[model samples]
Target chain A: MLRLNNIHAFYGHVHALRGVSLEVPKGKIISLLGGNGAGKSSTLNIISRLIQPKEGSYELEGTSMLRKSAGEMVKHGVIQCPENRRVFPLLTVEENLKIGAYIRKDKNIKSDMEKVFTYFPRLQERLQQKAGTLSGGEQQMLAIGRSLMGKPKLLLLDEPSLGIAPILVREIFKIIKEINDEGTAILLVEQNAHMAMEISDYSYILENGRVALEGNSKDLKDNDEVRKLYLGA
Target chain B: MQIIVSGLIFGCIYGLAALGLVLIYKTTDLVNFAQGEMAMVTTFVSFTFLSQFEMGYTTSFLLALLFAAVFGAIVHQGIMKRLQSAPPLNQLVVTLGLFMVFNGLAGLIWGHKPAGYPQAIKGDSIKMGSVFFTPNEIFVMGITLTLMLIFFVIFRYTKVGLAMRASAQDIKASQLMGIKVTNVFTATWAVGAILGGVAGMMTAPITFLDTHMMFDVLIMAFAAAVLGGFLSLPGAVVGGLIIGVFENLIAFYLSPELKLVYTFLLIIIVLYIRPQGIFGGTQSVKKV
Candidate 1:
């Protein structure tokens, strides 16, 4: 339900995103694949309004998000689970999750918190413990669970499995699929092409700040160039 | 024992001012070198309300706190906000500039002469075993402890408090969670200035209201914050008490004139042993 057209983002002298365009249809998991510095993170950051784009139109369900500030994005339900799991290191896990619901004024916050705990029982166990003390895998869970506390319509997952153990990575991907099935659209940025291809319904391959390839995940999986460059098959 | 009790009374005042410094530093990452001058100005404002306007002590104190809150918001919104993204050095210089400006302004408005200020409470010294305390000293410590408790509760239980803590920890992440970080910063300054104003009012009775009265307290407060590890609230209070007790011990055992020198030396030694301050964790270093 999100569309970014001809977006160009700059970081000082460097052109981080050059005329990049992509779309995430409602209730779908759209994976963007790229190597390091291929503008994957830049695309997510631009969508989250973390970095301003000098030229482009970003719309969520036909509503222009250009004027909306970064803090306003979450109110519109475009929540981002930022890269490196930016959990408040000093705050307790419960406190971190409570902050996730900062924009909500409804009384369902306690229920929403319970729902997050249902998804991540580990967070419940460490509710009072500081988030910085969490293991890498648990931190990832806390990050995602924290974002879910915002009741995101379009969840932006940035490297959720990065630096995580292989076993935990599988579990995380499983949760991603489960989250998608439950109707929240996901824009997942991943370097693990194999797991990405397996779960994503559609995929875009980014190279040098442009959309180099785009197709259905199954078709993209079988493409020779895609297999060679990303999947390493 | 008397020395310790008296030291703690002054320590509570130092801690009160340091709480503001730590709060502002935690939320905005700006070391407000001007905090002492700000407190001095607020004390002057209280004096104006008390004597010039013929207001009662309680009314004057509240009015001063209200003025401090508005003054803080104005300073942050009108000045500090402009330098939000500037280099830390530039920010430091700006606050130092504010220190000079506030100091000069206070002198221009109130004159340079020190004046007697009324205490919140008036009574003979209360004797407890070998220790004695004026009603004012007990009042200062009692109010400071109560304020600390209130601050801690608000920080722990409230949504705004959660947003504040979250923003302090990670501004970007808190924004992503829909916290209006600018509002948090504004609230931080307001609360910080209120705490600083309280320090000024409490100290004025003992030190007398003067443009330079808070100068010594500011240095000690900074030392206390550094000792407390800058990021920890409880650390700030404990650090203030440590500095107070240490200074008092030096004054009693050694030459009184050498107290400040020995206190600084002791701080250097303690910091050399624990660079992060007493409660500062490994996550982030203090900017100043």
Candidate 2:
């Protein structure tokens, strides 16, 4: 489980996250829904310790993560599949996947790698191929598969389906659900409300860097304001 | 044929030096204007070991290289690390500043006089039907080739190498995957410094050891790196060899004074015709 209590973050003169709070319970998919500039990515960045918060407390199962560095966050099993699938374009897919487990010293890395291949069989086919050469869909899969190589306890996905093909998006979401079912918690940020709500256990709708609404995904899907603004009902 | 053989021998030294520059630039995005000075200081450190401490050639050489590695790590951790997010221009200025510091420090410690540098090998030039090379030159070539091979193997097969490539391609993404990017940066500086140290040792025998000896070599090495595509390691070696041979041929046929002038002219032309150089990738290399 993870919690962000009354967090405030700023970028120079602009306020990004203003007294924002949220929770991600164990082995659950929690979607953070927002339009542009609603601080969706900032929340994830803070969680990953990429950017320091102006004021807040971040905890992972009661262990304070507020003072940890970005590099340390990954060892704590707080893995992030960053925005736009930032795979090492010049490296082979296999190399990229290996780098994902950079901090782990366990013998299960090879087996975990096989587990990733099972989720994205296409990745195994292009193991030796340069990641840059992969198609957008395949690159997204590589990005997620690479993160899975770290054996994330709490995975933060910025936008897994952005710029992806519709068919691939469906496949990716199906895998996301499967991954959660297998025990890893997920914090998904998306502009695609309908798709995200279909799989997320709970949802938070962010408006202007504030949580405007939060509830069970089903209830949020049927709520009048949530339906009007995000669900496009 | 004589000119070609000699040029290639010298080129190996230049290529080794350029490899250091390229390695540092590829990973940390720092041009390191101080590379020459850093090598010069390490060379002096070895000179002290050989002269003051009365150490053997092998011991002094190894000790200096070890010192260079630590020196590089210190430079990165103390200065370069802080400038990680600073503007490229600022980083450039900092390295240039270090160049001055190293130069002044070496001058104050070793004085301005150039000294005889003992070669790893001592013997007369071996002459064949058309080509001749001294034992030291052969030794230089052998060491350069060995180092290059070792680098290639480590880069291709090691976990650290994979992390380095990942860091070079995407620093933030590599961090997200749990890579201690700072560690990669430190390791890069250490390896680069060692290469520079080897280049310095090889060069001192020919040019004589002085605070400014590596300056001219550094210029040539940069030109070679630019020609080879700054991001490609093999490009650095090829670029160095080409520059070496080309400069030698020019000096043989044309005015000796015009050798460097012509080298610069050639570099300008290469950039004009193919801005990416011979092996440059489509993405413009980040200028250090």
Candidate 2's iRMSD: 0.8
Best by TM-score: 2
Report lDDT (CA) for all predictions.
Answer: 0.90, 0.91
Q: In model 2, what lDDT does residue B278 have?
A: 88
Per-candidate fnat, comma-separated:
0.98, 0.94
Candidate 2, residue B250: the lDDT equals: 93
Clashes in each model (backbone N, CA, C under 3 Å)?
A: 0, 1
- After superposition on all C-alphas, the RMSD of every candidate to the true structure, in Å, is 2.0, 1.7
Global lDDT of model 1: 0.90
The DockQ-based CAPRI class assigned to model 1 is high
- Considering only N, C-alpha and C atoms within 3 Å, which residue pairs clash in candidate 1? none
Say which candidate scores most in lDDT. 2
Cα error, candidate 1, residue A174 (Å): 0.7
- Give the Cα error of residue A233 in candidate 2, in Å: 1.7
Per-candidate iRMSD = 0.9, 0.8
lDDT of 1 by residue, B1-288 (tens): 999988898889889888999989988888999898888899899999989999999999999999999999999989998998999889999999999999998889889988999999998998989888898888988998998888878887898888888888788898889888887898898899999999999889888889889989999999999999988888888888888888888999998999999999999998898888888877545443
